[model samples]
Target chain A: MASDRTASQPESSRGYAPASGPESERGAGPRAGSVQCTSRAAPAIGAPGHQAGAGPALHDLDQATIVARAQNGDVSAFEWLLSAHEGGVFRLALRMLGDRAEAEDIVQETFIAARRSLPDLAAPQSFIPWLYRVATNKCFNLLRSRRRHPAHPDAFDDGSVPAGSHDAFAWGEADPRHQGDTCGGLCQDPALRYEAEAQMRALTGLLQAVPAGPRACWLLRDVHEFSYTEIATIVHLPESTVRGRIARARRILAEGMQSWR
Target chain B: MAMNGGKPRLGCGRLIDDVWASIDQPATIHERSCRDCQSARAALDHLEAVTRSMRERDRGDAAQRPSSRVREAIMAVARAEVRRSRRVPLATTPLGTIDISEQALNDLIRFAASTLPGVRARRCTVLRSPTPQSSPGGPSSAGVVDGGDVRITLTVALSSQVRIPATMTLLRERVGTIVQAQTAITMQQIDIGVEDLYDA
Candidate 1:
């Protein structure tokens, strides 16, 4: 009778990573200045703004079903939902806040808020956009509070991850064509690559100089590939305003880096 | 700011913004060589690099995710939401009552079960049959382990090459022996769930 025990299964519930921290581990990242894509930094999610191309497909994980089940008060279902979206939420918060602990707090708060607000959420299909809305609000609120009691001496600190420690694209996740194609023929010299990386690192602060509205739009477009409609939904601006912000953000980024380029 | 606003278009005559919108493909070969276009391209690359680097760091750094303390907090909430008993009676003596945490007992079972040859357990849970009064919000029971009977359910990752029936039989016996000898708890039922077969 004991030879073949029925296989016991796990609950498949997803757990939250901590937000409160000594915040020391993340202190090693692209602080105010340096940044790179070590094996640790690159997620298999492909590029944020770059359209997913011929790389490995990320379509296998179906989140819609998870969301539906979570709405029914299913704990395991909620775990599946958390597992699917937490990475993006954390990343967006980290970029906008520029402080790992604050980002962690935002992420934890986002999930908690999501848990509280799920009953009113009507559209499961629009969960990602809706999640973005909740997280963006939290980020904006934090930014506003920071303004009332500022900590830093300058806008961009440049005290991030040290240079040359981590590889920018170590895992070959970059489209072969991205590094090897048109741009490479012109800018592939070892020195040019080094300088370009340095200039990019330095440009981190300037990104903060971008007006908040356009910065949000730019990040939504460039960092997350959110469309005009998705962006308008989150920012509560008209579609026209969304388009303008994206354009303005691009222009500002290009202008800010004019000296570096 | 107007430095590139009036500059000549790239060899293809497309504005730098247009080229950047379709970064992978430039209408003209000018994308690689034009002064204004290169700046815009570098800006796009810089953003991409930031996203990439941050992601890698988050995945690499254990701190990026919720710490174990956070995990417990969430689990605590989950425990409240679900109606699962959290404690198991280990013994009863003049020193109040001795009990083992449901999670602690599971961990004990997991360590024992996975110690066998070709048997690696993932979620080893020592479950108790819920009584009529008990509402199962969580899995396993607080008083069930000391009740001297448990329904142990675990997902085992087995070596595909092993003799399934024989290996599992020996594993059940070995793990059961370990649980009884060390914890002195009776094995009500040891259920082995084969979650996946691994080549290694």
Candidate 2:
């Protein structure tokens, strides 16, 4: 049943490298002293005196420039590249781990690995998927290790998996009691509807119950709109398998969400 | 700043958690003074705050406002990246030519100058054109000539201990090779500006 859906079909919502010390850059000759008014050093938004001149327009670059510079030990270039893509990457990790800090750590580890292997990046434009692959592997390893040592419990582990109990992990059912606190509304008025809070909690709970792989697959495919080929390349999975996982993940999510009615 | 620790204790994680939980919410002073505990508390506080805010926002219809300043900052980071990747000059002078777009040229000059024997220091910049001075010789009398196309110029700050003539020759030869090979820019002249002599 899971294998029937394509990876591109919206299933539902889903979703390091070592980082250099935040202050390193490589250059020729007397390195230009740190740019005092550099953008990274300042708050881009909501900062005082933030006129148009304060911000320079920066077009997003494909991975090739980043890989080349990083290979040559240009730490700053690599860092900028990291910052540019971190939001999407971080969001994916957060969706999977349900822990922001752990997701951050995974991102850091992913980059460290990427930096070490930058020389092997044949095409810079192809680096994003490659990077995601590396990061996913690291996260999976962390998950696997946590499984082996039960003491280090992930957000997903709630004693059900170990006992071979499947139903114990409920999905998409929000606690009416904490509905006010766990909602995920984008622009609905809080005072307008008390029930929306309950809906949000249920959505979050359902998202939390998704196993990491399917969860990742669904988020990448549905929320992020990555192509099946791209998802496959990143996850190191067969395209068909990616499709199946997403389908399964979505069915579970949809079924879990059905209770909201 | 090292904490007191003799023998290592096993199950330290559990012990720490237990002790941490037992503390009646710490006074502001106590929390602020301890780095480790403070970090933990801050993490928890941040998580709680973020989650709470997210929930509150989810309950409302407030459009997520794009912070112009933050957007600008992000743009700025991207711009700095562009500048970093380009061949650009830190500063320009009247005598030297600076091309901010060529990393190859910068690397070549820096590498060549560093290799010059006894040349302990180096820096490079482009010279700005000087304003014309009125003299009897009309156009020639005006000192300003558009020298931008003449050559790729480099100003190397050298050490006083080195033979200026010999070092200059060696620098010209080596820098010329590196620049041509890396950037494909043939140089008509490599103007070596001796900014300051480094003490041995």
Candidate 3:
């Protein structure tokens, strides 16, 4: 039954959208050609900054006022907050996952989880760490999956590695001559690319060596500059334990990373 | 080696450990004067600096990549999240207005809510409109009126194991206190909408 739909559809248009629908007979619409399946922007539904008939940034209007509004199921307030932190959250996911695509997945998962457990949140103003914890968990889960399968490294001229072992060659072989011409181009910034690849490798190495509980604690406290109490709250570790893990993680990072530099 | 898992004893070691937790904090006087400790501290400091520097460098570099694929992936995730939240009745909760980032507000709300006893589930959010029409003026004139009046809400469910009304009142008081204490908001009102009542 599904095969007939596939037979009717042109071979050229096969990707996410068609595959996503339930197996049905009406999949016979003329397929759009080479539609870049990757454009992920949500259709501007409610409006640019608002969604679902909710307001925007009303959460910040006044703490009490916004809280009262949000409690009434105002999604605009939630979205306004999402818009404000999307960049930072993306960066956090990117660094944690060490892959842009995976980082994006983590960002999406974090918000979804937040939305699921959002009502559980007691304070609107303190959502950053919780969001990060969700993002970190999602990235780690993806990384675990990727590590199991392993794939060919991306051939970016600027020297990024899907896997860390190949980074040195990628960084060293990039051409300086072309760098001038390709300044704004994605693969052109050799020096910057080299550093990014190297740093990810270093972070990867450091994280692997440290224990799990400690690694998150350390990253939140040191690299990300979260407080001890905050780290404790995020990781579900005791404040003293958070302190200890951070200390131990730091000592390990200091010892292990010195060799890389 | 992990610390002796017993209660942490306060001493130079404990103090040293705290100082080491943050990279920007200076090495303590005791750490600087003791030759062996100083040497170890130096090693740790050097390693931390290089690793942090490498990450900083990587973040800047990754931004220049031409893969709109990466951007697409992020947007995909963002859109999926929005859709999922819309679909799940349990996912929708009124979180009050918070001037912080979405992530930040979520974390704070989670922390504050979880700490208070008897609270089962909660969601924090700022009030906003789907289409934020600018006021007659622009941002300057856009007050609460422009954005449907700013609000942050936290809708909570009492533990199925606890008394609903008592828990709700307790939550309202505690949450109100925490919000006012941690953030600069005189909460207009914590709705305390009790979604469920659990039988003991």
Candidate 4:
């Protein structure tokens, strides 16, 4: 679907008119904390901060306050909550679905469903994980539907198989020459960044071969850095099962990614 | 070397699970001295590196914000949901009854309340007054009456310096006047609660 084609456009530049009133002042861009790359050895993708686009009055309020207000049926507070988490939700969906439009649909559905059930969410602190659960279930449904109907046959058809083995380079985008280049801090180099992105695209394509359950577990654990316990709650699986699935997924991807070493 | 369910067995005859476990936790004594386990761990480390790199680049490249059309559609649905769920009875005549969206009424009340120098609206609920024949103790539901008086419960955060009595009276008067002037619905009661205090 050429999902990455819009990669460079800042979200605010897109024509979405922010809701009128105080929320309009909230920037519609990615929260700064979400995008910072951490140490690779033990990367911990922190919970998203709610500081972006906050007006002076709301600036001091914590996420719990915003959630509590939303629970009290404050639409503006809900909108702020939406704005804060939409980016993370969208990225999760995109990685899960690999289609831009479908991912966007999941984001819309997730928040709408969330609004309907927000009153029932007892703990304001559990909002993020609850939100992720909502999003993950939607993705699972879509994936199940796709498996039944085969809507996009070419979505996972990377056609990268070489000779007898599934070489990493055979996966369309990444080149063999860049195999060992970690591109860790060199992401600032545009050429390296582009290569890294291409490799990521290839990795996403490879993920299609993993079963949906393990795929989700792997993404939540390895990519998003959710704790195993948190992932179990989000995916509705036992903690042991979640760990097993993640290990199985790693084994599968490692075999396919052998050439990268 | 042998295979366990198509997975390569380590030279120590351990299954792939051992390699994964060693990488996930601190290496056991045998793993620290085992060449096969070390080799497997090195390969897994490279895979982890690749996954981490993918995550970093994916975050960098993925669209950080949803497109405008999607945002508008989602918010439109949200606003509609709020209006649908919380409509308040405005009037009822022989011809028909008129209702006002609770969201709209809340917006009006909030705006009116904010005009006061030291108050900020936190939450507002408009409840329909029970018809006179109903049980006096019966609960009054929102948007239930064909045409009748409405009760408003507004919660606000007040600035520390505002005179409590005067601010409360002024807030009540302003809110009552605005609802009456705009919607022509008589206010049976205006309950204002100070839920928080903030500096002016």
lDDT of 4 by residue, A37-120 (tens): 111011111232333222324334434445646766667777777766787788778878878899899999999999889889
- Residues B1-200, model 2: lDDT tens digits: 11113111112121222222333355356445645444333322322322344434522222222223433444444445435443333235698755545433443455555565554212333333443455565655122323332244443334435665556666666766766665445555555544333334
Interface RMSD of each: 21.0, 19.3, 22.0, 14.3
Model 3, retained fraction of real contacts? Answer: 0.09
Candidate 3 C-alpha error for residue A59, in Å: 10
Model 2: lDDT to the true structure:
0.45
Instruction: Please state the error at residue B140 of candidate 3 in Å.
Output: 46
Angstrom error at residue B184, model 3: 38
- Candidates' TM-scores? 0.47, 0.43, 0.44, 0.63
Task: Give the worst 10-residue stretch by lDDT in candidate 2 chain A.
Answer: A35-44
Candidate 1, residues A9-64, lDDT tens digits: the string is 11121211121211111111111111111111111121112111211122221233
What iRMS does model 3 reach? 22.0
> What are the runs in model 3 whose C-alpha is more than 4 Å off?
A1-76, A91-99, A139-204, B1-3, B6-29, B51-200
lDDT of 2 by residue, A54-163 (tens): 01211121123234444544434455555445555555666676666777777666666676686687654456677777877777777777867878665332212222
- Candidate 1 regions exceeding 4 Å error are A1-61, A150-200, A258-261, B1-19, B28-68, B82-200
lDDT of 4 at B98: 78
What lDDT score is found at residue B17 in candidate 3?
A: 67
> Best DockQ goes to which candidate?
4
How much does candidate 4 score in TM-score? 0.63
Better of 1 and 4 by TM-score: 4
Q: State how far residue B116 of model 3 sits from its true place (Å).
A: 34
